[model samples]
Structure formats: structure tokens, C-alpha cells
Target: MVKEQKKRFVLDTNVLLHEPLAIYSFKEHDVVIPMTVLEELDQIKDRKKDVSRDARVAIRTLENCVGDAPPDLLLQGVPLNHPNAPDESLGKLAIFPDHQVTFANPVNLPGDNNDNRIINAALYLQQQSSEQIVLVTKDINMRLKAKGAGLEKVEDYRTDQLVDDIQFLAKGFCELEGDIWSQVSKVSSEKVGRDTYHTLMRNELEEESFYQNQFVIDQGDDFCAQVKSVNDRQLVLKDLSRDRLMSYHAWGIHPKNIYQGMAMQALMDPEIDMVILTGPAGSGKTLLSLAAALEQVVEQRLYDKVIVTRNTPEIAESIGFLPGTEEEKMAPWLAAVTDTLEVLHKQDESPAGSLQYIMDKANIQFKSINFMRGRSIQNAFVLLDECQNLTPSQLKTIITRMGEGTKLVCSGNLAQIDSTYLTAVTSGLTYIVERFKEFDGSANVYLNGVVRSRLAKFAEQEL
Candidate 1:
């Protein structure tokens, strides 16, 4: 009896950008590239700002691997007829010689696009040879279509798997053991006020406490953390000067809706020097952080100014040059900040006058992360938006910029990260949240259930 040969697989264009190294993912199996895939790569060859350029480079690298090989050995260009019955050039390359390979365009039987052509080629090859064929794609719709078209196997490019069992530390409490609790109790009576004491009590589980916002430090074997409740009463943390802590408050901000109470409690902390907010898009991470900064700067006068900056290291492509001055260049990125400010202005009694007054007072400064290299931010409310895009090195640079008496809040959506080198599990936001989990001076919050338009939320889930 003869042994059956293993199946071959063909990849689509989008799969490569979604995962650049997908070409090498298949092991000990034959890989085929229909000629149409090369044409798609050529169309995106000159795209400088998009990941398409990276896809082009990947294809070029593969081409170099096949350099000067015999036509049959290389699976070089093959002729295939399109649905329009025109002979078109499609490159064919054999990744494995022991397996039989053939390429031909299938009949354009309804709902056929460039991707369909590639699938049809695979189908034709499967029928011609004894080996089965599988289609790999990142396009969900394309995958479904390929299945409906009678392809035996279809799979997504899964190189970008998120870390399993990942949990955010936003809304939970910690516990401490007896020894750790005794140590904390001793320090609680020092410069810390009553609200801080109570918050620590609420976060303390036996002997453990939730420190900062993100960390639940082990207080030895006997302690744990617990969340505090105020019986419908919101608690505000008083400043060291015995003044009410002020925060940016505005309507239509989603975090204000879900995280307002927690924000209030966090701001009351005298020990927490940094806070991190992570959520999906429209979850109000940035707006809430800004609100807290504004309150500290304008109302409490705790900070000299509010400094807002973002690093566009990931989405730097197609950001385009800003017309006119540097401020104009920054306007597009600062649009969200302006929108939040406008909302705050509308809530004020004298919208125009109050905005101008705040501007004149130098209470708010919008700057780029590039300009933050040599600066030490002291006695200010500093906000870093879109921090998920920052590489770990870049994030470290931003965090180290904090000067004495300064409070820093870094906010970004882990799911919406555009950085090719990072994912929700490995992004700087996750790294910070995990690393700072034990620090009493830091806090982390993850906002779920986006408060954007009803349709937007639906699209997020459905899409």
C-alpha cells in the first residue's frame, strides 16, 4: 500500500501584514504562492507609511531566496486564465519537490475577487494532484467564503496570539498578612490622612493591600486586599494641604460614568505617584486622566500645570505633515484633548472667558513626546496618551521623565494598538500594569464596555 502525501497550503496577501512571518509558520508541509499574490505585493511596493510596505519587503526577501533557481525547482511564473478568460501571469513556486503541484484559475462562479482567484488556484491544484490543499488568510470574510466554496481546510494566521488568562487590575482589592499590616498601620498614622487610611483599610485583605492602582503586593502569607464601599457616598482624597482634591469633570466622558468613583478614591492617595489606565477605544481613559490633572492644577493648585503628550511611534505612518506652525502640526493629534477641553468649557459658567483664562494662566500645555527627551516634569499633572504604541524602551523614557512632586497618568487602549511589534499581552501598558502591581505608589485600571455610540460598541464586538 502507498502512503498518502500531506496537503499543501497557499497564503493570501493580508495574512502577511497581519503576521509578517506567516510564510514560515507551516512546518514540513508544502507552501504555494499563486502569481496573483505577487501582483498584490507590487501594488503596495511603494507604500511608505502602511504595513503594506513591510509585506512587500517580506515578498522581496522570499524572491531573493528563490534567486537563479531552475524554473521547475523555483516554481517560477505560471500562466493562468482569469474569469474574463484573459491569460495572466501568476508566479508559481514549489516550496516542496516531493509533493506534486499545479496552478490554474478556477471559474469565477459568483462572489469572486482577487482572493477568490487565489483560492480557486488552490482548488485546481488540489484536484490535479493527489494532495489536499488548505487556504490561509487573515480576512474573516475571505475565510468564510473559502469554506463555502468547498475548500477542505481554512485557518487564520495565528502568529499574534495574545497571552492567555490576562487580567487587568483596575477594579479589585488586595490583602496583607499580620506582619505587613502592622508595618502599614505604623506608617498610616504618619503624614497620611484619614481618607488614605480608610482606602488602605478597604484595599487590605487581612494583611494585604492594593497599592497604587494596579498592584496587589503580597503582605506575606496572612494578608489580602479588599475593596471599599461608601454606601452611595463618594469619597474624595484630601491633599497634603488639607484642601479638596480637584479633578477634570465633564459630561459624555465614559470613564467618568464607570470609573468616576474609583478615580476619586485613587486621587485621594498620598502615596500613589503614578496611575495607569487601559481600555479599548472610546473608554474615556485619556479624558478621565485629563480631568484629574485639570482638577489638581486649576482647582487644588497642587500642580503648577497640566502637561499632555502622546507618542505616535506605531501609527506614525500617514499622520501627514501639519500645515503652518508646529502647533498646527500638533492640532490633529490634540483634537481629542481639545474636544475634552471644549466639554469642560461648556460646563463652566463663562465658557469663552474661562477657556481664555485657563490658556493665559498656562494651565495646560500640549506637547509631543519627541520634545520630552530632556525635560524633568516637576509639580505638574502629566498625561501620556496612546501609550500602548510606545515600545518598552520608549515607555521607560517617558516614565523616567517624572520629576519631584509630579503625578503621571499613562492611558491607552491595549486592544487598539497599531504597533506591529507589540500586542495586548506584551505592550508597554501591560508590562507596566504587571510590573507595578506590587508598588503602592502606582495604580492601574482597565475600562471595559466602551461608552461610545451604541452602534460603535456593536461594531466593536461584531466586527
Candidate 2:
């Protein structure tokens, strides 16, 4: 068999910003960084934005990889070495001087923008090199432009993407047909404390194995249970009352569907450290998360304070120009929490007073995702909203900030992502939902219905 020649990958700036260590993601393939990408990173590194941190990290990563090489060696290529894989030889890292490319080529882009310059670099390499030259970028338009410019291969940077399609994302629950007992040939039942537990073979359900903390409900039957433990042979299910789950209330807010019921149950459970909610807009994700936070902080006194934070698109660079304190600056983006509060207390004799009372009682603090780094948050009910716009690395930064006794509730609409470099499958919400589905202390729920309003439901379904 003929050994295939190594392909050279020309990375765009957004790929580095999306994942700072993206250079190592291509395995042994040669990685090329166009000077245009570096120049763009340099310009963005000084900006007062959350992405600036990523830009700085990407710059530092390039420095660490090829900093010590001489000019000729840098142009030629520096050997890429990683400590974890010392035994395996890796590819070389090279910096392409795209700005100096003045030769006329038929496939060259006419524009002088950074994107065009990067595409031109790939074009130059494709002409000069014998190996396949592929342009890797996160921007879809750039990919199209690269392909249009006659680049043989153009691809998206998908090393961080855990799923290819959004349909396969974990829904936190599985609905079974008919009664669960009808499918099970044998079962072992026992009682622990006030909860009833049943153990059956993994294949007794006649479906895929369930993950820990995943809920199982009957389609037309009254059976409802949660998987407390899962082994290779059998699963331990905690029998739950369907009526009881439907009756669960958090700060006077009751679940309208079994999905929300499971979400509320997970949110209110003291044993659960993280709860992820994903669904369409008006699916009660924000409302349920806020209600659960308020219940834990004010009514139940399980937590000291309620810290409501989110990845605000505007807050990246314009937050400094906003008026008042950090919390006040975050007010506009966090209006969903306030709106939910109003709905929760609309029946009060003094709605305004009740709103203020709950706000003060819960000690709610609106925080920005940019300011959440390097701080340990403990004994707080954290509601992270609009997380669909975040990347996997960005979400990891926030999740790692949680200290002891912190309960994090992440809610987002995958279909409503605002990030240009992210999609429903690559969103951080989808990443965490899939990553944490098997964790015993974490639970995820995809709210299935639109409970906001009739008009909103119609819009969500039709438009």
C-alpha cells in the first residue's frame, strides 16, 4: 500500500479563536498559519471583549509552538511537539507570509481584506506545494469563498464539535410505549427510605441503555421512573409517581409537561450539581430555571444567593460603555429573569413590591460571562442563560468556576444561537448536555413544548 502524503491545513483566524489549541487537532497533518490570521489575532487581542482572551491565547499558543525558530526555519516550518505524545512524531507548524504574495494567479481573490488574503495564502500553497492544501475555517461564507476561489478542499473546524446533528442530542428522558412492566419479564423491587426502587435487566426495557439520572416515562401508561444507577447487566430505577412529578412546584410555578416536570425535579434536587435545559424559545427554559433558582435561594434556603449570568453578545465589547454597575449593565440581557419573576408574582396584592422582595430575598445578582473567570462561586444557584452562543471551551471556563455547594442551571435554545461561528450541533449547550448526560450528579432536560403563549407557539412551530 502506498503511504498517503500529509495534507497541509491553512487555518483561519476564527478557527484559532474558537479553539486556541486547534493546531494540534489535525493529528499529524501539517498546519499552516497565514500571516493574515496572525495580524487579525493581533488586532483582536487588544480589544475589550471576551474573544480577546481567546485571541491572546491563540497568539500565545503560536508563540509557544514556533517562537524560537529563526526566520528561515519559521518560513520553512518548525517541528510541532506535544509533551503528552512525546513518543509519536507530530507534524510541522509553518507561518505563511501571505502579505508578500504578489504573483498573479487565476484563482486569486480580488479583495484585499484579511479573509481574501488568507484564501490567497491557501491558493499560493495549493499552487506551490505537491501535498493537498485545505483551508480550514469556521466561517461558512469564507469556506464558500475558498471553494469558489478554486481551493481543492475547504472545511469547518469541528474538533470541538461533539455531535454532527442536533437530532441525536440527549433529551434527558425516554418515552416508552405502553406500560413498562408489560415489557419487563422479571423485576426485583425494594424500598429504601421513602422511595421505591426496582432492578431489571438492561434489555428488559427493549431499548437502548439508559444513562444515570435519565428519566423514563410511558407513552400512554402511568409509569414514571428515573434511573438511579446503571451497570453492565441491570439498571436500578427509582420509581416515581407521575402525579407527584406533575404536582412539583417551584416558587408557585408548576410544570405544564413531563419534560418541565423532570427539569424542575432535577433543578430542585439537592444532590444534583448541574442541570442543563435546551429547547426552542418559549419552552419555559428561562422561566423554569429562574423559578427553581428563586425556590432554592429564597423559599428553601438551600443556597445563599442566586447568581444569574449569561453570555451577552453585546457585553463582549460594549458593556464598558453601558451605565451603572455590572449588574445594572447586565439588566437588559437578563430581562427574561425579571419577566419570569413578574409572571411568578403577578397575583400578589403588590406585584412591584413582591418583585423587589423576591429580588432582595434571593439576593439575585446578574453577572456577565466575561467577568466570571478566575473566581470561585460557592453556595449559589447559578442560572446561565443563552448559552447556545458559547463554544465548548468558553462553557468549560464557566463550569470550572463553580466551587463547592454551587448548583448550576444552564438553559439555552439551540435553534436560537447568535454566534456566527456556532451552530445547533456545535453549541456549548449541546456539548455539555452530551458530555454530562452520564454523570450521576448532573441531569439534562430538553423542554419539548412551547408554554409561553399561543402566538409564540405558532411562531416557534411555523416560523
Candidate 2, overall lDDT?
0.89
What tens digits encode model 1's per-residue C-alpha lDDT throughout 1-463? 9754565778787666544445555544566776677677777666644455457656765665466677776663322222232353332335332223234454333423577677776666666667778788867788887788777788765544433435633333332334554544322232354434233333323422333343232434422222322222221122221112223242323233324434544543545688777767776666677666666676667789888778674334534554555455666787888787777679888887877787656468777776686788889888888888765545776789899998888888776787755666657677677676556577666666666678878877888
* lDDT accuracy of residue 264 in candidate 1: 42
Tens digits of per-residue lDDT for model 2 on 226-259?
Answer: 9999988998999887888999998889999888
Best by TM-score: 2
The parts of candidate 2 lying over 4 Å away from their true place are: 1-5, 83-89, 102-105
User: RMSD, each candidate, Å?
Assistant: 11.9, 1.9
**What is the TM-score of each predicted model, taking all chains together?**
0.51, 0.95
TM-score of 1: 0.51
lDDT of residue 236 for candidate 2: 93
